[model samples]
Target chain A: MANIHDVSKAAGVSVSTVSRVLNNHPYVKKEKVEAVKKAIIETGYIPNINAVNLKKGKTHLIGIVLPFLDVPYFSQLVQGISQAASVHQYKLVLYQTGYDEHQEKEALEMLKLKQIDSLIICSRKISLETVEHYQQYGSIVLFENGEDTPLSYTFIDHYACFMRALEYLYEHGHRKIGFSVNRLEGANSSQRERAYRDFLKLKGLPFHKDYIFKKCLNIEDGERILREIAAFQERPTAILATSDQVAAGIITSSSNYELKVPRDLAVIGFDDQPIARAMQITSVNIPLYSIGQILFEQAIAVEISHKEVSTELMERSTV
Target chain B: MANIHDVSKAAGVSVSTVSRVLNNHPYVKKEKVEAVKKAIIETGYIPNINAVNLKKGKTHLIGIVLPFLDVPYFSQLVQGISQAASVHQYKLVLYQTGYDEHQEKEALEMLKLKQIDSLIICSRKISLETVEHYQQYGSIVLFENGEDTPLSYTFIDHYACFMRALEYLYEHGHRKIGFSVNRLEGANSSQRERAYRDFLKLKGLPFHKDYIFKKCLNIEDGERILREIAAFQERPTAILATSDQVAAGIITSSSNYELKVPRDLAVIGFDDQPIARAMQITSVNIPLYSIGQILFEQAIAVEISHKEVSTELMERSTV
Candidate 1:
């Protein structure tokens, strides 16, 4: 196996100069650093980063823990976080927990084990109290919802966002409206549900728990939701979906059932994703990419206490 | 400030037992393992993983480099890779390069710097020759269109897949068919283009470069493609979109242009994602999730060989 000595000999540099370049020390000359890199490649040398980081007491790795990656919302967040972290020269290590508490615990273990420098929690099934204990290891930035006492967080105000969706449906002469969410008990879903109930009560319309659809995460879930909506005797005239995928599914499935959107059943979708824009589905535009960007920035910057990412309503033909 | 002594005392175990549990020694008692974990949480001890790995010479971190995470194809691949890596007890470090050569180079740097144990390049703008020299550092698995010497690669036969898509269009009695791709000169795109021209020649039809649409990555690009198709003085009767998002865009955009699928413009998309299933769009089923699973498995398996995944045609509503 080739070593630092071989790299130094091949590059015609001293052993210490090769060491400095491998350590990412900025004081080394650019050409010398380039030569060392080329020599290392030619010699096929491995630097033993574990040994280097042991001496330096640091690892430039940022851990991002979330439920899913295939979904549009989380993927957008991942993209934003990856870009922001890359700008800071930090790599992202993902922990896709998928509502499994054990996986979430393993991610926290990474922080405690010094396997990563900092952590960004996009969403967690674990309680804030459980995650708070690991704050001493590194900066843990929460996304979507968290208390501001011991850690920083970046999230949208979902209650207000849902209120806008509800208001838009009401203005279009739709009194009986339904909605969809990924989970019934998640922090964001509960907040939106609260908004749904309060808005209906303020307008003196009846709120039915049966009208809310849970366990809808993808387009398939959205398609299944249509059947449930159709089965309701006192069905809604319009629906506000928690995601664009769900709204898109309903619109596409509506054709199969001879149900035309707006003319037969008005629709409002969340996330204003590309599909939403392409289909002209009225939506609550949560800046998921910006939120992901802020999550990484705040986690790495380690300066802010808390921040709120705003969501706007994008009105289109669907409603 | 918590140390080994504190953990030992707190767990009511000897210092040696704590060390054994920390090292993941198999002979350690189960209850002692639980106690040590509990003490770890109680004392908030931050284990120096760098020091431990320095002696063992293993990081157990597998690097996964790709273009984008928000797109369906890449995200599905990410999900599969993450799941497969998690099962193997190896964590994935993602470098979402987004077509940036510098970022792609940074991923290669990680292997040389010993920051990652191995690398799985999902797709790259970097040449295979440039990546070939890094095989000595560790296993570097290429995702698509890689050589079968000194490195392992897992890829689908895009040439065959595109030919099937083209033949399907031709057999349906459509003489003219255009296609969309993310990049014009990509290894897979160029192969598909060659397949397009070859199939046209075999059928005694002239190939037109104007029928091809390049630089399409998302649904918005598909929407834009509709306008371009309309502007064509002699447009194709059908389209073979490279991705499901682009296909969704074309289908959705068709409504605005008063063009009906199959009747006016038959469309076929690649990647049988949830969006395709929801839209009932005919597509080429590339097992992206399985390919990602195989990428992680092969990169870690460390066998010196290459493999090819197969694709299928899903006939649905659009075609």
Candidate 2:
């Protein structure tokens, strides 16, 4: 019930002096700090942390911009980030944008408004140029490749990862290949698309628009992909999924559709999550948790830097 | 950067008046509000949201205490909560305690420190007595039955759900049955354990200590359970898994161990996630997302109330 002014009055010191003690300002005399502490106890004044954070200009809170939390990739990333943040005595403020531009902008504006110390964008819909404009407000870390920009980022080589997967499928005597992506406009998806086009050109294979399945992120989407392919005149024999969930969906429902995995359709998934391991779905190990930790570190770092994380192919039976 | 004092001096108003205008206090004069706005722009004073929040005694931040985010149940709940929070213009501050008592205490301290407006404990390790001590600070919402405590809660009737699942397995003619749990000491798990015991007693079946799988949560744990069952001379005919992830793990790995699903071991999982549907595993639907939304509503509500949510068994091929 007691305010800061009450503490100051009880301490027989100026309000500013009491504030200095509260914020642990080093310049304050030892005697004044003792007096403020005694006064705080005497008045039963509960210090609002927001007040101290206002004076210190540090909230010890970081913002994480992600499209969704139920997705394994983003959830895994959040787990990693959350673990690292707890170690550093920081907490995460989640901005679930669902790839909405306005929602993403709201997160960026929070940084401008000094609501959070820094921000980590796991995945985004806003343009790089727009994100670059907010760099002066606070440290903005990206989970995707922002190498060309002046922001800190930790990214996996989607182009190379896609190319490697494509090459693996190509070497296995498969010329007709297809892939799935959550959004066609995403930066990572664009790179993946380019890689697919280049891989097809290298193999002298024609590109089919129907082969590229958009909005394929969840497990049920895999069934949808199967149905779409079942209707096709000539379906691709080898398919690359955006996530293990989608691949798991395809394999699980394949039996119902009178199809056998690998024998009828070889399926490759990204993010070697637990699902991939359990189902034996060969996938690209993205190490999302580790990437999340790096993103958090970048968010709090003073210097702007960009680092590319490595990926591995976890070979299992589904492919 | 211009401070609040600068804005006040430029506006020719008292510092308290400037703060009142910034907080949109009803007592502030309309002319003074316009003057403060003009002065804020003129002085390039970006009102720090923390300062405004401090004065208003409202942060618009709700703390969520959870063990882990990578798990499907927790992640799905968070997704639901996040969506609801966004609709109400509130952001979530995640405190991933990993079930540590000390970490849980810190989240409670944040509530007492006025860092967050309310706290939503999805799951926890702390005692109800200790949690009750902080109710005067702000609203604290629980995702488990807290009927005895003076706190708001939205809980699933785990006891009834467990009983129903046991009876369902009994009706299917499975007398020798096993079950899995993440932690023996968890509140929900304790209720589930009691329900299992009661069901066994009602059916005149013996309880086996080895039948209870401890720390069984993830997909890999399902494989561990399978390995454990294979070693047993007298194996149970059916198993009740803690989660769909665990059931999926068991079914996925069952093929490797020469075990056919329902024919060999009828498995029933909880929290009918997408993985459960994809794997055709019979599971009890917990509806975590809807519960999450209710948890958020309870967190912001002023009065303390407890509500029990219903569950259903999704009859799939595995059973």
Candidate 3:
């Protein structure tokens, strides 16, 4: 029921000041902005952005397509997107693609039909070529796992991140090191595999085929891998996991074999998740949250290009 | 650019079969569904639903207002909603309200102005009265923590759930029991506290005000609370924590004080999260994913009412 006039009157500011604040224009005094915010809250004023969107033929809704939620990796990325979207005064629509091409097609359709202003593909099953084709319809930004795409992307160097983890183990006097990965085919895992092989070769270490562990997704994966290692006659002294969950699993399950981490089998993990800290597993801290924020920021732009976020190795008690 | 007819012809079925398959209609034979699916993929067909949405004057967008993501509680619920929404051909727009009244207001305004078809308040800062006020503008289904409001809600009986936990501990020959809750003022926690006191009095056990713990949101909260309890000369022999994260924290931190669970202090947790399983903490499984599915299914409907999901006590090693 309240209007700009009521807000301005309550805040003791001019109507133009209120307008500037609502439109998010710069150069407004801090005290005046705070006053306007307080007054808006007190008066319960909601500026009618729908009217503006209607006139501009824009819904001001951005679409984000991803596989799933609840996983800390994707959820943290989404959290960053949520924060950035709210700041920009834009709403985000999440399409749970779940690696299904049909579900992904619906998200692309939302862009082509002008239902959403732009599309940010966080994860997808469709090939790069298919997504590149949708670029003509609207801005399509990606969180790419590998190299640069034809369209705009935020790239994280999985190869470099994994390499850092391996080098850290080698520097800590580890000779025989094992590797754990979630998927063998994905861009991230593919690059990580390359890094593992390359790092071992460069360091003049023997490549143990049995040390290569795959499908290490959950904590069970870590435990499963550790159990296999415990039984093997020639087990590696160090391990690099694809996820913090896997690392945490190794720590908890290691008790069964009387293996103390760093003393018996040093372990390094990817993703600095809370579990990693709680379980005391060192990891390659990827800037996934920042990547989400940066990608969303660039995705809404009229013209955009590739952006890269680097990963840092976190030192902890594990190694 | 293959159409429905081409997909049907390729699959050896009529256009209706292909259409139904594309629309995800139930009752289709398994082989027929697989054949049609293969045909669609083979033909690279994409169904055009934009025209249908335009003609029906519907956006087919559902807004989900939650406090945050990355936490298992909300993330799991959103996961369920995302799965159900996709099945029903609706897109979810996320509003990470973060218990901010202004952010929640933005979501409510989205409903009032028809930006989204309906608003699903997963968590909110606004009172039930304010939400009830918005009911006139559009459908508003809530994930309420407290008592029933005038509007529809998907209730998880926190009081009954807590009462059951207390009774279980009492049955196990535990006279002194402590309680851990996140928010003290919310409806769920308030009811939980009342149940705790009522159950204690009924069992002729003395109520110790010092045993009540608050602000137990994360694992650290559990650890901090356990540290406080360790110093207490008259610490309870048992604890019922509101979350599994907190319970895990207590267990891990207890080792520092030379304490063992079940023998030293029995701990029962709420929410059967993965951490509970990893740490072997007995907890009340709230069936959050099903709650999400059922809530979203009802939130999209024209007529909505209150629905309650029961909790199950999962007996594990800790208890």
Q: Highest TM-score, which number?
A: 2
Q: lDDT: which is higher, 1 or 2? A: 2
Order the candidates by TM-score, highest first.
2, 1, 3
What fraction of the native interface does candidate 2 get right in terms of contacts?
A: 0.92
Per-candidate TM-score against the hidden true structure:
0.89, 0.95, 0.80
Residues A37-60, candidate 2, lDDT per residue (tens digit)?
999999989989888788788899
> Per-prediction DockQ, in order?
0.70, 0.86, 0.24
Interface RMSD after interface superposition, each candidate? 1.3, 0.7, 4.5
Q: Can you write out model 3's per-residue Cα lDDT over B228-309, one digit (the tens) per residue?
A: 9988999889999879888878887788888889888999988898778777789999888998998788778877677888
lDDT ranking from best candidate downward: 2, 1, 3
The lDDT per prediction is 0.87, 0.92, 0.83
Q: In candidate 3, what fraction of native interface contacts survive? A: 0.43
Per-residue lDDT tens digits for candidate 3, residues A107-226, read 897887667888988877787888888987778988875244667788888888788788888889999999888668766778889998999889888888999899887777888988
Q: lDDT tens string, model 2, B47-80?
A: 7888878878999999999999999899999999
- The CA lDDT at A14 in model 2 is 99
Model 1 segments more than 4 A misplaced: A2-45, B1-45
Pitting candidate 1 against candidate 3, the one with the higher DockQ is: 1
Score candidate 3 by TM-score against the native.
0.80
Candidate 1 lDDT tens digits, A259-316: 7888988988888999999989988888888888888888877575689888889989
